[model samples]
Target chain A: MKLTCTVNGLRIEATAEPRLLLVDFLRHQLRLTATHVGCEIGVCGACTVIVDDEPVRSCLMLAVQADGCRIETAESLAAGGELSPMQASLHAHHGLQCGFCTPGILMTLEALARSGQLPGDEDGVRHVLGGHVCRCTGYQHIVDAVLAQAR
Target chain B: MKPPSFAYARPGTVAEAAGLLAQGDGAVLLAGGQSLMPMLNLRLAAPDTVIDINGIAGLADVRRDDGRLRIGAMARQAALMRTPAVGEALPLLALALPHIGHPQTRSRGTIGGSLCHADPAAELALVAVAADAVLTLLSSAGTRTVPARAFFLHAMETVRAADEILTEITFPASRPGARCAFRELARRHGDFAIAAVAAEWSPEGLTIAVGGLEATPRVCAHLSRELAGRPFEQAAVVRLIDEELAQTEPLEDGVIGPDYRLQLARVLLNDCLAEVLPP
Candidate 1:
């Protein structure tokens, strides 16, 4: 099947099997490897990405299913050469170590930020960051970084 | 893991979608795909054809008229949370919406999909049965409305024929002064419940449903009738729930044993009743 979608800011046209997952299409076909696929059943947020500005489990969506949608991967954050505000904040707050899940977390928070739902405080940030599991950084720095962006 | 290869079709109208479904060569309707996609990836389901109905027109609106709330099947669960009308007019939905997976999953999970999926532990399924909602099912043949109790046949099964699609659901509005409450006990904030309960209570009567207990959400019809005339004493209600649990064969999900579920169901029933019923 031929899949056409807007990714990051570019229009992409690619051929894929009907069963190809959106995450694989981005990582393998589009060469956008930032969106990791972990716990492929949609429980983990490692596959999270923005589809039409809404955060979704890319592992749970097919490339064919997203034929005409707008998608944003973690690569979009650094598309301009310099770190985006969120990327910089995550670094400053020490929000990552062995960052396999960073891209998905970043995209999830990015969607929240886009929606103006970034929490103003630590607890509020944790509340909104539910369902995302972070095995590293103890989540405190992630909350701190998210708070910085929220402010 | 990737899903097995399949043919896909995006129909622009429900009639076209139904027509395609009526063709039925191992065809499965794809709505939000939050649940179905995972199953596909796991190869638990591999329909030869996936009929994508998200493109279908007139299946994503929510409206209120004639003492009921009509929610189109394709409307996302997150959309329901954002709708002030749902929160203001439907206490049961407002209470249950936040518990259907996390906000992220809710963004793409549709109400119809969840209800049609009919997981025994699904909040929407249990809530609809407790509320006695009605569903509009369509196919190339025509349309039929199935009440919530009749809609769910068993765990992960519904009365919906292989060729039919559930298009809309009408939830009867709660009567004035009615107290509606929902509670679920899960391992985490968004995990499937170990035990869950929903209740609609008023001076007139009681309607209650318990999830994670049986093959389907168990509406305590006998207990609801008993509570209609029974006093609001916590002890009495607890005893009544225990009596009902005695007759039920709770389904064990490996997470908890049936005995634990019965106790948990009793605990949830108490908590839910405390919120809606007088001391």
Candidate 2:
């Protein structure tokens, strides 16, 4: 199947198998390897991406589903050599250790902040990130990062 | 994990989508794909064709008319949560919204898909039952509205025919003085519920719905009758909880035991009742 969609700010097209996952297509076909596949299942938020202004698990979506949609990945958060506020906040708050879950968290948080629907307190930030699992950081710093951004 | 090979069709109209589903053997309708994608990857479901319903028009609108809230099947959970009418008309659904998968998953997960998937532990099922929502199932022939009570047959099972597609869900708007509450206990925030309860109170009586401890959403009509016109006393509440728990038979999954789930159901039900009852 030939699929075409805008990744980040660039329009791209590729012919791929119908079974290819959007996450794998972005990483393998487009060579944009920032999106990580942690739990091929939807349980983990490691495969998060923004599709049509909303966050969705890329691993759970077929590459064909991305047809005619606007997708934003972790790479899009940093443009022209500058980091997005979400990326900078994650770094300042030490939101990542092994960095496996960082990309998913970043993309999700970016969408939340950009949508102007983010919670206004620390506990609210923790509640928002509860979907993503991180063996490291204990989520204290991630919560802190979101809280800092909320302010 | 790679999904088994299958033909994919993006239909421009609901009629075309329904036609494709009817013509293709073992065809599955794809909405958000949050639930179907996992099954496809695990090879638990290998449909011969997938009818992508995303391109179908008029299936994503959430509106209200004639004292009923009508939500399109493709309306995302996040979109439903953000709708002011949902919070105003059905506050229990708004309360349950934060408990569904996180912001990301909820942003793409649709109420129609969740109800169609019919997970025994899903929060939406409990809400639908508590609110007495109506599900509209459509096919090439026509459409029919099935009450939530009759819509779910068993775990991951629904009354929807293979050729039919779920179109919309409708429920009476919440009364101005009605009070509703939802409670669930899971190992983690986003994990499947160990036990969950939804309760709504109006001038007429109380309605209670339980999920995650049975094959389908169970309505405690006896308990509701017991609480009618009677003040919510501790002894009465305890006896009602005991009776409800005694009637349920929870499955023993790896996460928790049936006995533990029964106990948790009682505790959560009590907690939910406390929220709606006045001191």
Per-candidate alpha-carbon RMSD to the true structure: 1.6, 1.4
DockQ result, candidate 2: 0.82
Error of 2 at B121 (Å): 0.3
Off by over 4 Å in 1: A121-124, B229-231
Name the DockQ score for candidate 1: 0.75
Per-residue lDDT of candidate 1, residues A17-57 (tens digit): 88888899999988888899898888888889999888899
Model 1: lDDT of residue A85: 93
Tell me how far the alpha carbon of residue B24 in candidate 1 is from the true structure, in angstroms, after superposition.
Answer: 2.4
What tens-digit string does per-residue lDDT give for candidate 1 at B178-218?
Answer: 88889999887788888899998878889988997888998
Cα lDDT tens digits, model 2, B77-186, are 99988899999888889989888988878887889999999998999999999889999998998989899999999899999999999999998888778889899998
Residue B205, model 1: lDDT of 89
Sorted into a CAPRI-style docking class, model 2 comes out as high
